[model samples]
Target: MTTSPPLIISVSGIRGIVGASFTDDTVRRFAHAFATELPMNARILLARDTRPSGENFAAVAIKALAEAGCHVFDLGVCATPAAKLMVLELQAHAALILTASHNPADWNGMKLVRADGIFLDAAAGRRVESAYHRSKRRTGDGRVESVARDDVESRLLRRILDVVDVDAIRAAHLRVAVDPCNGTGALFLPRLFEALAVSAHFIHDTPDGQFAHEPEPIAENLVDLSRAVTEAGCQVGFATDPDADRVALVGETGQPLGEDLTLALAVQVVTERRKGPVVTTLSTSQVVTDAATANGCPVILTPVGEVHVVDAMVAEGAVIGGEGNGGVILTDVDPGRDAAVGIALILESLARNGRPLTELAAALPQYSIEKRKVSCSEQDLQRALDGLVQRYPEALRHPVQDGVKLYMEGTFQCPWIHLRPSNTEPVVRIIAECEQRQDAVELCAVAEGLLRGE
Candidate 1:
């Protein structure tokens, strides 16, 4: 018998493989539950990435929301960040984006946004989850309206252009390569490059949801993008996940600058101009910390989630914030991970510094981060984490509120390991970083051994 992946219900939202755990019935029920929590006839925004199942799932959600007495304004085929920006621009009461982010084409999920244009925080998310399980559907005269993709795209582009050094970038006359992985970024990156007067080469530009490779913008998956950069003589290469919320980069020499450096480079740009605290998740690379420190900016570490980082960004008045996994958040534009904004900030850094991407990356403090996952029951996960605590008693530990993060030395930039249960998958994720690749690999191996009760 073929078993399906379990549905991932987390603070981020619900994600699962389509036609199995996540079906039309599942979509309708969740949509109804989401709507029942809103005001009667409340204004809501709806958007979806280019997953093959997204169109149908979105229709199911639209019907459920309208039947539950909410007006839906649909932004068909749009980036996740675009959907977020439109929520504020249109003053919609709430928004629901149908996307599974970097997950494969067979997967789809719902990301619920509050009125403030941010993903639901833990408390708000809990409310939605509770409603999903307990609330019943209601009916009223509600309607669906179409919001043009151009408007959504323009609003996002203008936000990014407003903050970046457009003049400097234009003067640089930079050539770039983009691989949107046949997803939402294909819809808007061309327009953005045109506006910035950047010469761009695009691959996997089709928005047909049939991904050219794995949807994740990791180094191994971006070989084509790297080749495009070198062959086309581009200064940098950008690869965005399906919903365009995350981006990984390829440097001028066709070298994949792992996702962690994406935030480090952006931090270098932002902290150079704006001197405020920088916020990042605990699992983010220490290079980001080094970048912030070099610019005399304070660094704040949050639990491993975008909402956690965004919350800290708001409280600390952070000039910039993001995750290690190629997610960048600039509160000036949106309090969410935005690939468009990340791309713009990176380009501006190259332009203002008059440096190549490879050189700029090399100048930052370097660290090697290795990630691995092991499937385990929750009880076993807790047991292994307990064992780690006993084994690393002398190590400086973090808050333990989110996960177990401990630094070998009593400092922020030292070799470190973090073990946390995955909210998006049925496994425990182990991340470790060290000054050398071999050390990082060894650290993860240790974590894996502990996880296996060895």
Candidate 2:
């Protein structure tokens, strides 16, 4: 038996700070739990970002998989999407990615992938968690030393190029700047841009597990990337978190565009080309609907999280879908949140339209989204959500398994508030978006207060 680290075990997976909350034993136990979910002689894909602890965790994972009688395909230091793609290609029974995503450099975690190349849905995630609690251990002789594939980058780019207008983008010869924040994206984004013939200036491109700035690609953390775009004389700038699953872009003239534009632009591109349903999360911006409506396509709203969005997209056969956090999931190419796919789609949108990213974004509906993060115990997270519902009795609630989202009545706008527990941390994420920024901020503040019992 091992002492459990101070970890946040949610549907997204297990997350904890390295050397403290994420200890070696926790890694072994979680790996064991994940391996228990696999069948005998199952093949598993294992990968990670550039976090310093990644190799150590991967080592632990290899041993656990080997002991569980599973053949492991170790894709060392690859993007989250790349790991999932390999799972689909290998017909593996399951996959695991060691990445804390946008969390700080000190944090590390795991993302469990199913055989379908998607993260396990809520039910399956719960089963894995249950297996963890039950100490489900499988003993068998697997392999000790595993071979790690090096072609994950090229394989991922192949899918992107196939879905996008490769030639047009190459012809455009657009200049772009990117900040991968010293994570796994540094391994492939530059190469992908070079393959597309797009001139790219990469900052923090070294895969040393050292973050140059805050890992989240939000506006506040992208000042340097925005400046780099201007200094490099680039048309746009790009930023990706550690795992490179989400991408935030900077428009021309070195201005930070909201992360929402990534999905909005991708939605616009797809809906204009194909008239179909657009699936997105409840927490996403209304720009999705605006883009969808312009092309005579309806928008379908699902719960927050990549799996839920992908599940909805696959079930509905939606042409495009993703989250507002700069995640773009093109079902034709991939059904997961992928920054690489988003970049390709956005670049294609730029190339086909012969317009700037700024102009393309300006053409969309203008809405303000205010987000607040509050650290809370799991009990308090639920209590706050319950309080919000009690406060607004007449509000319409959305059906999302992870969080509580309510459309409240207001004079000018019916603000929607999505209150959900963080998938990666011990915090509650309160997001409110509306046509007016002030309204959204106020709603977010009110929700945060309710959650805090103020």
Mind giving the per-residue lDDT tens digits that candidate 1 earns over 1-454?
9678888988778899899888898888888877877899899999999988999999999999999889999998899998988888999889999999998888899898888888888887777777777756789889999998877778888889999999999999999999999999999999999999999999999999999999999999999999999999999999999999999999999999988999999998999988999999888898999999999999999888888888889898999999999999998898699999999999999899998899999888778899999997887788878887788788888873777998987765669999998877778999999999999999899888888878
Can you give the TM-score per candidate against the true fold?
0.98, 0.95
Error of 1 at 366 (Å): 1.6
Top candidate when judged by lDDT against the true structure: 1
Cα error, candidate 1, residue 177 (Å): 0.9
Q: How do the residues 1-454 of candidate 2 rate in per-residue lDDT, one tens digit apiece?
A: 9653378777677899888888777778777888887888788888889998899889988888888888888888888888888777777888889999998888899898888888888888888888877877888777643444456667777888888889999999999999999988888888789889999999998988889998999999999998999899998899999998999999888999988889989888878778888898888887777888889998888877788889888998899999999999986665588898998888898899998888888888788889888976777777888898888898888766558888776421336888997777777899898779999998888888877778
Model 1's TM-score against the true structure? 0.98
Please state the error at residue 434 of candidate 1 in Å: 0.8
Clashes of each: 0, 0
Worst lDDT run of 10 residues, candidate 1, spans 127-136
